[model samples]
Target chain A: MNEKLHPFHIMILIYMNQTGVVIMSLPHLLAENFGYNGWLGVILISLVVNLNIFIISIVYRLGKGKSIFQIMESSLPRVITFPIYMILIGVWSMTGCMVIKNYVYIYQIMSYNTTHAMLLKLLIDIIAYLLIIKGIYTISKAATSFFWITSWMLLLQLFFIKDFEWARLTPFLFKGDTHFLTGGFIVFTAFLGYELCFMLFPYADNPKKFIKSVYKGNLITTLTYLIFCLICFGFYSFEQIRNMMYPLLDLLSYIRLPFIERIENLLFGFFLFTTIVSVVLYSWSAQETFARIVPKANKKVLAFIILTFGYIVAWFPDTLSEVGQWLQYLGYAELGVAFGLPLLLILILVIHKGAKPS
Target chain B: MRTMPKAAALLLVIVIIAGCGDQRILEKQGFIQSTGYDLNGTKNDEKDNRLMITVDIPKSDPEQRMQRETLTAIAHSSKEAKILFAGQTELSLVSGQLRSTLFGVSLAKTGIWKHIDTLVRDPSISQRVKIVVVNGRAHDLLVRDYPQHPRAGQYIDRMLEKESALMSFPLVTIYDFSRDYFDDGIEPIAPIIRENKKNISFDGIALFKKDRYITKIESKQSLIFSMMKQNFKKGEISMKLGDGSKKQEYLLFSSVISNRNVKVKRSTKGNFNIQINIVVKGSVLEYSGSHELSKDYDRKKIEKRMAEYIENEAAALMATMQKHNVDSLGIGRNVRNSLSYEEWNKLDWNKEYPDADIRISARIVIKDFGKFK
Candidate 1:
């Protein structure tokens, strides 16, 4: 593989994964746990995750230019390495499918009455197939273009400032310590994408710049999610947000554009594109992880097969509420794979030194 | 080179597929301007909880010039009724355009959290929708013909906005209602809309203990309640001063603005004392007196009168709300946030709130009068 793609490309991929699905869903999940202080939890989680990313990047740089997979393979047996790689790939693919499914559910609820569940699954599979066929660099390029375009929509939230109630965020600290831990865990899930750095570590043209790119990407996503959470908390009270199935969509509905009556429709349209980019990048990364493990397998064909399987998994969730609950469980499992495994691998690598590649 | 045609063909297919999923214009589907929930007396027995929902659909044709056409359906649940109503209507019943929701006296008294939960859960309905308590039946409020506004929903929405601005009622949106419904301490209140001749006026605000409208605060007192609780940019306060001839004058003042600061302090004895500071600015729009007052009136006398009037109004509003056991002012919320839930529970707010020492201090500064001499 040619080391032509910069660490900036890795940053774009991570940014796409974090922003698209998490921003839309985090407020509701946080509200369920922390009530009104959900936005505060988002801020806390972002700060914590960025610190984790910084620490992880330092650890990666310490390992010279070798990827986490290489470090893990050298540190552990091939049996453990193969299973860990497969599990990591599975987590990414599941998360990708969940993101696509969530966007489709939002679209069906907001825009069209007759939007078939199968349509979104098919769309995800098609995009994944095309991106995989073109190779990982093409997918990274598409993500980079999307990152630039969607950065503007972050500004559109300013229009809703008038409706924000600062009083809703009152009594900042919880009455009890229990709420903080529960809320912290939920918000931590929103920052799960930063761990993508582990997989994309080898693709960075400049491995030394990996820390810089990861910090920049994580910072952007953190700030964006914080703003989104604040806007949601400001608009809907703690209880209203908890009751709402799709709190972000509800928040957008309150925003009446000067000319356009429904702002959620426009948001839903833009979100569809971002959601596609998010799922495609995740699926492509998952396919790449699989390709690395089995050198004999064709990457494109494997990508298609995995994406089709993901579509089936996504389609199986019966209702919108069920899909959301399933995603929470998936998020917990992905969090373990994304952060837990890497931390463990980094710890093991520190204990045992790796031999130089011939 | 061989894959170029296949890529082009694939791009063409993507474009075609994308074109198939374009957005649906909301106006094309019949938009529901407002929804009214009422108890269906005819449908079920006392044990059965049946609700009839009246949806106001705007007539599309300008020439038709109809105020509004309503479709009513009774079902076991709101979602069921909405679905049933959709089947009855000619156009798709779009809930996004919904501006207000009215609950009938009976329906409101029965509690509306179940109905509100349905409204909030539905993705189509917006959180900003104004929720109000109708004086009479919700169906009558929706179905009755009005001369002023073309649509009943528009009429009710405009009336609520006007009253809320005038400091007659605290602005109660669907979001606010839902917040109060779930909060342990704070109770919610919705403006009560009633018909007078051909037009509608906000006569009072319906106070909700949870989702039920437990009590009502009439027009003048509702103003005082609003002023004490909410920030107002514009309003009017008229005072009848003195007796005939010696009656110096009755002042009709407009352009009234007020900012109230409420502080809750726990006394050394463990009881709470509330201190209210009302900073007011207004113009004497009309003064029927012998003295030809300039742009600036006797500052001392105006200030004294303003303080007296505000104090009297505030006291009366508080007394009225207490008499009815309606804590719509969120005194309970202040207490809960100030103290623990266990502590708040031990001291019955309904009993203690009225007895709590409420000291009000008013500061008035006259900004302007419309070119008066």
Candidate 2:
């Protein structure tokens, strides 16, 4: 619990959390919203996320590197802060459970149709639980390893360059349907996991250096998203991408080597590492929020409670669409907390400073 | 703590064992390599089946690895046929290894979208599986055994792969088919194969308007269409050029590299004029023309003649496509790019494709002659 994460670990942790299971369907979402050359919208979305990151950095500076709970509780009334903590706990744990649930749903659909989905999700949950019990420092260390394991997947994009066509990208800019609102929202949600960084203030030795690592982590994630979206746009036509359920998976399936075929199955299995990291991180955040509320609770017991709560909740959505619906709602709520929490903290800090001179 | 470790180990053991329940035994699973769909032409009032589906499942036994078990079922849907197929085989039929899907000419003429939609929907099926059109009954093609090709399914798969690489015909997978089918600017196409004597042969390029097979490009003219359709580094094209007074002149170019450029301009009317320019460079492997290859000027004359021959052939090819109202060359894509978004949306490309004036020109450069020259 006393260990602090290195700047490199922080960077890779943020990158891993941002990438989760959404990457497989991201190309289809972009094509649906922005049409041809919709990949250009990722840069715009990334800038908005960077602005959010900037806001969080401001909170870190104004609060003098104190924990977010410390800053909020000291200024706000217990009545106001208590419900905010409850909402954060609900939103974060639900997001955590939904991420794994969505992954397991897709896994069952792609590989194990006969296997029980909850059984599969339970297996994933157990793996995530083993990691979450170790705390954030260990999770960050494990995340650095997961980052190395999954980042090499971007190199597979090279295989598509032979068939990639500029004409398929088209000459139009943002020529898709009127669904840009939902598209922007979905793309915005892909960047949602970074907002959990505010919970990491106490774990940072230097707040200024930690914020820099967050930006670096976000840069890596944005580039990864940009590369994937561009390859999918150029490899598949606008209409084909729109019709595909998971264009990235299909692209991976098309890769055939002399020794191996259907590498998508293996690569998708490797994605388990990143998914586990994301699940553990989100659950850890929820557990930390729980600890703030109940100061005397055991950390391990709190983690168990959160995981059990998540496991029970995962049973309701037996199908992929249902899981996806819940995830979309949770994503929207997290996005609200991501922006709202920081602005609220800044409001408290400014009022406190104005009310009493230093 | 010791009991906890033991409990964890027991849990791991149970999970490891329970996870094996979903394991698929290789010998027990019958992998369908080739599937053929044909319209039932027989008049059987009792069994009103629209589709005659045939599958080639290779035997798992090493001694009979070369042999395949062919199963045929008549059902309205592919899944229905799949259930019927499962009843005949002890081995569980799976489509994870499906390599090629063949549609009979009769069935293809009607439209293949519904069957293709099912294949696309199945998560187990690969997107790279070759989509082929059969000139004869697809049932006949799959049912017969070729003497020379011990494993006909594997032979067809390898042949399509090699031919597609040689640019004899474009390789149209399910991914390509659906991509072009969905794109408003271009239509889809597939290669046609037929049973010829003891083996299967590449017939030609099958053209489609939407999902129905409209026409075909003859094998001889397939090279011309391939050149205009895409840019490739290697292919072969043979052309015949001469006057009535001279001996019949024929030139065959090997390792032909071709690059195509399409320019679209709005004509005086509300229609469009499309200009296609193809630059080809090749080494002469066989020349029976009057021009002497040893001389630069004579070689230039042969090049000019070959260029002229290609231009005329492409013009004829474009005319045939326009006559049938099939924009197989993706000329509509270029025209769409030339217009604004609203104009492209309002215009019916299929209607404007035939009325638009199209021209083709070829520039051929002989990079190398043979050692004989």
Candidate 3:
């Protein structure tokens, strides 16, 4: 309990979570939703996400450095807080499980087609469980190393510069679009992981430093999304990007080094580290929520039980589309939590302040 | 002691399930190095089946007399053909290492998106695989044995790679093919290869409208096409100058570097007036002209003449493209940039392309006339 997270660790944790399996399909989604020069819309989406981050910061300032559980339990009775905690555990664990399940399903399509997806999911679950049992401080520490392992893939975008064409991006802005509302929601989900920082209010060495790091984390995620979407738009035609299921994977497949070709297979595996950080971070959050209900239980045992539940739930979605449909619902629910939690906490803080004057 | 027995059983189960996944062993799997697609037969053939898929798999054993094995099968679709191909060999045919996919002129002229879609859809195939348009039947090019070359597949792959560097043809891959095909402003193009007397040769560049081949730019004009297509650091261009009455002179430019710009302006006539300017810099390796290199006056004279020659040739090439109603140079892309999105969408580019006023101008800079002054 004495070990607190550094601001840098918090920044990386937010980044790794925001940049999971979604990156591979993000360009295609943008192309489908916003049409020509859809990448320009990422800046707008990032700005909006910053506003959401502002709300989370307000909760931090209002709650006065208290842990989320302390602030919530003090305001609401056990009857109200307990059901909220259960809902949080359900949504958080399923979101973590589906993120990995979607990744393994795509991995199956890429290389291990005949392998049982459940087996691969179990393998990833075991890695997540090991990391989750270590607790938040270790997970954040491991995330910094995981960030290094995957961030170099960004440099690969430079190879595409020779073929990237400004003309291919087209002059039209937001033309040929079909679904702006849904597209905005999907893109907003790309910045979903930063909200987990709320749980870290108590763990942060200083609330002021934590809030600043949250903005920096969101900024980094925005830059990563912009770089990827812009390169995809320039490297491919508008129609080509829309048609592709995973433009990032296809882009990686195009890269040819003297020693190797089809580097995507290996590079995509490196993403497992980053995704493991994300899944573990989410599982840790769920386990923290679970501990509130069973206060006397050991933390590691609760984490194991939560992960076992995740493993069982992950088995339900057998195909990629089915998993995607499940992720759509979870992503929206998580986004709701991301915005809803901070707003509710702020409302509670305001009401408490008003009643204290009486 | 009790836990030891349980752990042993769990590990054994894990090991057994691990082996159950699809394992593509190198020796057991036939790594398809190159593939060819041709029309099954003449159009009049009674059977409705239309695809003839040929694949070249390099033989692994050095002791074998043949360098590669070529297999051909006729079926309704490529996947069906793949199954037939697999039945003929002990190794399961796979496309992970597929280096190239060749389409016969016959098939390319009709349309090629169906086969290309299959290539793009398969997760195993690399997008960098060279896409080619064979001048004759793709089957003949795949099956032919050249006396001094490696296997036909490897030879063509190497040829395409080398020729691409020479700027003799555009190095279109599966990615580029589909990318351009999907772009509304421009069409896709691929290098054409033909089975020659002793070996294969770079035939030309096949221009495509959508996914169907429209016309071709010959090998000689391919350099001109390259100059207009994109900027290059190394290439060679040889031109014969002078009218028939005067003695003709030859000028060979090597180590060529060039940059091109397309400018589109809306004229008073309510149409796009496009100007294509190309700036070329290279050393003249050979000049049979009477102009003396040491003299500034003669150098200017030759430069002007060379520039004029390039301009004329480029204008002629543009005419060929316009006549064929193909915008392979991506003039539509330039025009699109100059207009609003709604205007571009409303305009029929193909209908407008042939009537557009396009002009070509060149500027030539000779760095060195050779090792001599």
**DockQ in order:** 0.40, 0.63, 0.71
Query: What interface RMSD, in Å and to 1 decimal, does model 2 have?
Result: 1.7
List iRMS (one decimal) for every candidate.
Answer: 3.3, 1.7, 1.8
In TM-score terms, candidate 2 sits at 0.97
Question: What is the per-candidate TM-score for chain B?
Answer: 0.86, 0.95, 0.94
DockQ of 1: 0.40
Every candidate's lDDT: 0.74, 0.86, 0.88
The regions of model 1 sitting more than 4 angstroms off are A1-12, A35-38, A47-51, A72-80, A176-185, A296-298, A343-358, B1-28, B42-49, B62-67, B74-76, B83-89, B161-171, B242-245, B295-297, B340-348
lDDT of 1 by residue, B150-262 (tens): 57888788767777767756668887888777655568888887866787777787888878888888776665676777667777767665533575567766787888877
Q: After superposition, how far is residue B254 of candidate 2 from its true place, in Å?
A: 0.3
**How accurate locally is residue A11 in candidate 2, as Cα lDDT from 0 to 100?**
89
lDDT of 1: 0.74
Model 2, which residues run further than 4 Å from truth?
A354-358, B1-4, B7-11, B42-49, B63-66
lDDT of 3 by residue, A232-324 (tens): 999999999989999988988989999988988898898898788779988999999999999999998999898888889988888899999
